[model samples]
Target: MDLQLQGKVAIVTGASKGIGFYTALQLVKEGAHVTICARGEKYLEVAAASIKQQTGADVLAVPADVTKEQDCQAVIEKTIAHYGKLDILVNNAGTAAAHPFEQVATALWQTDLDVKLFGAIHCAKYAIPHMKQAGGGSIVNITAVLAKTPPASSLPTTVSRAAGLALTKAMSNDLGAYNIRVNAVCIGLIRSDQIEKCWQAQAPQLSWEEYSEQVGQSIPLGRIGSTEEAANVITFLVSDAASYVTGTTVNIDGGAGSAL
Candidate 1:
């Protein structure tokens, strides 16, 4: 079970809560020095404190909007300044803006793309050279199952995720020469704060249990995924355990995206 992550350095975006939060804590569990980022400086500080308290691990919380170039660069620069090297880059800063296909406005499309697609792209752009200088590194893009499944009700998220998948592949192919492995994990119905936000706005009538059940029932596993479960996959991909893995998107959906 040695993930070989001890003493390594990692960057996890949107770590204020949800999957990014879990992923950061998980890395700390494996003994990696983690730097987490999000737009809200307030939430980010609270999350950083929680991670440190929970794991007794050192954490640096950088308040940076991954969607912007300056912020992305600051994340990289700050990591190197603090940790001296960056071992893993988890592009987990994304949002859910799915609506009926016809109702998705052009502005909404642009907003989603700016945060999800360009955010990953910008992070990768800065990290590649650093990885080259450091001799190698791993980049894990946090996409979702919708990339392949393309839920009818979720259009923009799916389209943008599809682009993320492409980004993962192309980056992997191009960066493999530098010993940088780029891969993505397609998240399923993981219980997280994002779901809470959506539920509050979309299905507030359903109690959490009922809401979870409604979603989990569709999974062959008979349950929705956990933050730790998703983090395990991400950690594996970024760890030496998955050294040969790259140019791929591993679906973490509980048979939700099962191929015939």
Candidate 2:
């Protein structure tokens, strides 16, 4: 199953750990030169080093907060400067923060929108032009299943992710003529560093493995997803294999999402 991604250039946001890290690694595995960005410089560098060691592919670690427009622009600029082209942009920088609607503050909503919605916008804005110049490219937004199947206490994240899904469709429509494919992956209960942190903070007695197992039992697939599982789909979306896939949202959620 060659994805035909060899020699392509890609930039993945929030790549220090979790799904983003695995996506970047998978891109490298498919022979793409990858630039991975995150807010923490130390972790980003370490991630890059680890990916390089594992795949023996070129990896660039760029420390940039995607919430800032300038940082998003810098990510594209640096990738182009080094790789001379941009073929894939993975807008994967975000976190799931939920609060009761009545308890949600304006600041909280703004913060969520900044990272999930505007973060994708800024990265796509910068990447689109280069992609057009290079003839074509792919953009994969990492959203959540809650965007389609909203649940209680998922205030700001739900709203912002729904907006991200809309962005994926809009970008796909507008950029289709330029051969740039825009798509999104809506996640459910996936194993990641953020989830681990939450479990540690909320239930100190339960190890992540135990916590994940408990949650997985409720899902239709009888297990939670892995970072590699999500990454595999993303790599395909960004590759020549998914040449006709655009303006679509794929649910990577072990049948967790209620909406089709």
| Model 2 residue 169 distance off true place after TM-score fit, in angstroms | 0.7
On residues 1-260, what C-alpha lDDT tens digit does candidate 1 reach at each position? 89999998999998899889999999999989999999999999999999888988779989998778899999999999999998899999988887998999999998889899999999888888888998999999999887886767897898998899999999888999989999999988898876778778877999877777777888987777888899989999999889898898888878888642
Q: Give the distance in Å from residue 206's predicted Cα in candidate 1 to where it truly belongs.
A: 9.7
Model 1 regions lying over 4 Å from their true place: 197-214
Candidate 2 lDDT, 1-260, residue by residue in tens? 88999999999999999999999999988889999999999998899889878877669888999899999999999999998999999999997789889999999999999999999999989999999999999999999999997889999999999999999998899999999999999988888777777778877797767777777887898777889999999999999999999999999999978887
As for candidate 1, its clashing pairs are none
Query: Which number leads on lDDT?
Result: 2
User: How much is the lDDT of residue 110 in candidate 1?
Assistant: 89
